[model samples]
Target: MPQATALYTAKTKRCEARKKKRRMTEPTQTESPDTTPLILDVDGTLLRTDMLYESLWAAAGRNIAATLKTCVTQWRAPNLLKHALCEIAAPNVALLPLRPAVLDLADAARQAGRAVHLASGSDQALVEAVAQRLDLPGPHFGSDATRNLTEQSKAQMLVERFGEGGFDYVGNSNADLPVWSKARRIIAVSPGGTLRHRLEAMGKPLEVVEDRSDPFALLREMRPHQWIKNLLLFLPLLVAHEFGLSVFLAALMAAAAFSIGASAIYILNDLLDLESDRLHPEKRNRPIASGALQIRNAMIASAGLVVLALTSAWLVGPPVAALTLLYMLTSLTYSFWLKKRRWIDLASLAFMFLLRVLTGAVAAQIAVPGVVMAFVFVVFFTLACVKRMTALARDVDHGKLPGRGYGADDFRALKVLAAAGIVLSAAAFLLYAFSGHSGGLYGSQMIFAATVLPLTLWLFRVVRLSELGREDYDPIQFVTHDRIGLMIMVIGVALVILSL
Candidate 1:
């Protein structure tokens, strides 16, 4: 009983000491009377991104269930969650995006001889690392294992240390309103519309940092352009030569379901790939990595999309709903695990493409032949190879180190696979046309010959572009915009409709 009591007493004393240390974090001296003591908010003020969310997703990327468990257990103590995630995910501070204007503001304050300090709700160690990396002067304040120094806590701390109105604060959200109420000068960065209104309600003079992001950043986050790949959901209709309005509507419904499901996967993939995406030349500018959209919003969007996907698939029928669930499960697995595995990632992507065709058949009640399915799979598999090969070859040319399985020399073997895929697809297309099955449905069997011409032209063109190191762009997106690729699509679609 005495030993147990002694252990409890020791733990109580340590906790008290930690709290005392945090309470006394204020600098003993504000340096000079002339110092206005400029304070910077870390997340949305100085950085284009938020570290807490970045860390959360980074940790989640490794082991989502374990991360979720830790977060849930620490929910009652928000500060503990902050501390745990800091240790588990500790963001790549160097790669984190910073606002140029915010940096300039800090620089000006320092040059004017103001005492600059960083204070954030992010973990103490993480915030200090950021301050060090930015070469900022600070008696920095941050959340600890016991206290999340944010909003009210942060305002109270600064008020006690510097007295009301003694310091200037730079902040960006509604959470910063409390701190701003006590600050001498209010500097806001990229505040949302409602936050802007609330900032005005304070009746304090506002200094705004103009946002230069695209207006469609949210839409870009959804990646509607990538939905073009989901048009594969119409392949079964096209191959079966079903042009009835009802069948087309069913295919359209199925397409919508698959596309929405794919978007959810895209958002999830972007979250998991956040760190690596920040290192990539083109991908670094993605909405998530570039901080154009918040991770919380992205998660909510993913959930909503999944719900919509299932609803739409159910409207199509039971078969399509089941297929949609399968696609989502396969894609989630690919995003969490298979994406980093070499050839498996390619195979998974190809299978996803094939699933679209299968769902289209089920949705439209078409009896597409096995040969046609093989053709569709090979076509998409070749496109997947093109996508992977172009990216690796581009990375190698740019002198960036490769990750997620393939190396610099791996693009060559992918090129071979892409060529083999194209050859096999062509063979399948020819076999289907000559089987005398297509002739009974279409006005002319010669339509397949004409359709193959444009497809062959597009496939060979994409391959040559990959060889020339000019295919750095997303192969799917490129098809939507490229002049020749667009022409090929137009010709192919027109030929099919004309034959019908």
Candidate 2:
């Protein structure tokens, strides 16, 4: 008990010393008589994200049960919760997204010989770390063990330090209203809703820094374009020449179910890969990575999508519902574990694609020929290899892929394997076209063989583009947008229809 008391006393003294040093060095309104001090809010103002949520996400990623237990224990003690979370999952200061405009504004204010202070509702330790990382001017204030500095508390503290209307304030949310009322000048960053209306009532802000991101950011996060891959579910119906109303409707429902389930997986993957995504050049702009969408909202959306998918699949058929559940489980496993293992990730992706075709067959109540199943697996497996090759090719630095076993050096071997996969897929198609089932399904099996040519050409084109380091890492997405690929696909489909 005495040792614990001594440790507590030492920590208290250190905190007091730091506060005293800040007070002596940082200029208040009285010390800076010639220039008005500029006070800035941190979360959603100076930075694109809230530190509290970021820390909590990291904590949850580490151990969800332990984090939840800590939350329950410290439910009534905000400061203790903050400390516990910080200790569990401190953010990488260098990777935290910063608002360039806000930083520029602070820099300009400092250049004009004005004192700039960072005041936030976040823990003082976090606030201080952020300020130090950015090399911001003057003292930074934040909630400590004894106080949760925000709203009225923030306003009161600022009023006492700088006096009413003695400073300029920059912030983004409704929580800043009290501080704004106390400031001489108000600068708003990405202000909207009630905050915008209140700022308008007070007249135009000194400056309004607009956030330049797509309004359809949430839709983009869902990646509707990628839903085209789910159309593979219709392939079984097409192959079986079963275009009946019931089969068509069932196929469509299955596609919808798969799309929703895939979206949930995508959201989960994004959340798990937040740190790596931020480090990635292209992925950093993703909604969750860029802080355009809240993690909490994303989690809720993922859960809702999972439930909707299962329900939709159940409406389609019992077999389809089982397949959908299997797909979800496989995808979740791949995302959390298998994706990091060499060869296993590619195999899992191929299996997933095959599952779509199998589910489609079950949905349409059709028994796909063994040769047709072989063809589907080989084709999708090849396409999966192409996807990975493209990703590795574009990653030019030869650096290891985050959370994956592949690297740039593996590109050559992958290309050879992908080529082999393409050849095997063509062989499977040929076998199917020559089989007895082909005679039953088509008037001229010879015409069905024509599909192999276009398929071969499209696969080669995909490989070439990937080797050239093209932007379309997803071969499915590439085919959807590529005019020549689309034309080839149309001709191929037409040939199959002619044979039918």
Candidate 3:
């Protein structure tokens, strides 16, 4: 069965090549002076654009309030605030930060007297824009709104531009393999998965070029959004009147240190999960998993991140430094053993949230209220539970959780656990608001804050929508964009301010 499957795959690939060949008019035996012979894949090859797409879509949703009439018109919007915010929100992706080595390769190729042709399955306009930015000469090949330049179309374009055995090709996917095979020198820039293994098995003359682990993937693996969980550390400082210049500086430094530390952990996690991540749906694009980033380099980046974080912490204060160390230690534990165990994993995540609150307290040099810490614990625990539930739901939707210790069957139990967490957290909040420490102002404000119940109900609705695949996969985004959720949040904030 395995042999047949592999053979069938190979046959299908061959058929794809034949169709591509049929699409093209014969290439000139003699080349035109203006034509570039070298072809580059756009998405992962020439420039990073996945985050850009995400940002665009996210912005579109955010702009749904503004009622964008057309795609081109949206691009024409004078204010690029949402665009800029999108970059900040998903730096690992939106920045489409170029890989240094690929730039070097392009420079080397250009210097060698080869013309660069940008060919991507993404939109032609995007490809053209990037090519222009990179200073590649005119006439790039890419998918258009009308005709997608993917699969056979991509291959056909390559063949048309560079006759069989005429040009060198650079690419990084199984989808690219059929076309890449047509190149005289096949540069598999970060190749892996079934494609890499199959090519190796076929004894193709392929040279693999990789950057340090993909910065984006490395960044994601670290779950930097979880750094927002560290914002809990800031709440204590905020409540304690630690928002002055010096205190703010300390908090900023602490946040920076934590972000760096988290990024480092991502480098390590990718190194550890290289094989498993490859099988994952979304994670497969990661530098380490895709072979675009080297494991050794990822390790080095990890070390650098730690050193930088600790050094920054030391500059802040001894107490802050100590707290940072604890956070780092906790993260290490989560990475190694905690992530594998079920309830323990969620507990560890909640604990990390609590520590961030402590770190904030240390940064502000104030003792956080116990009630505040308890509230953070409950809130973060609920969020953590929801994350697990989302994962389990995704597993059920997809029929498997290929990279994590989960399966489709776990979805029901996970959802129930998540619901319980939400209930407990809400109860804790209500308890804290009504406690003896709760001042008269706080007690009065509790009525307004009670509005959180409806908000929670809406959030629950959104989460279930996400599980049902209607909401965005990003939880933070889901919260930020859900109309009812955002309005409730605004009301909650108003109540908190009134109490303060």
lDDT of each: 0.85, 0.84, 0.65
RMSD of each: 17.1, 15.8, 21.8
Residues 308-354 of candidate 2: C-alpha lDDT, one tens digit per residue: 99999999988899999999999988876788788888889889989
| Per-prediction tally of clashes | 0, 0, 1
TM-score of every model versus the real structure: 0.86, 0.82, 0.55
Off by over 4 Å in 3: 1-227, 396-400, 440-443, 471-473, 481-483
Measured on C-alpha atoms, candidate 2 has an lDDT of: 0.84
TM-score-better candidate, 2 vs 3? 2
- Candidate with better TM-score, 1 vs 2: 1
lDDT (Cα, 0-100) at 374 in candidate 1: 90
Q: Candidate 1 vs candidate 3: which has greater TM-score?
A: 1
Residue 266 miss distance in model 3 (angstroms):
1.9
Give stretches of model 2 more than 4 Å off.
1-34, 59-89, 123-125, 143-147, 156-166, 181-184, 196-213
Q: Which regions in candidate 1 have their CA more than 4 angstroms from the true location?
A: 1-33, 190-206, 212-214, 396-403, 442-454, 485-500
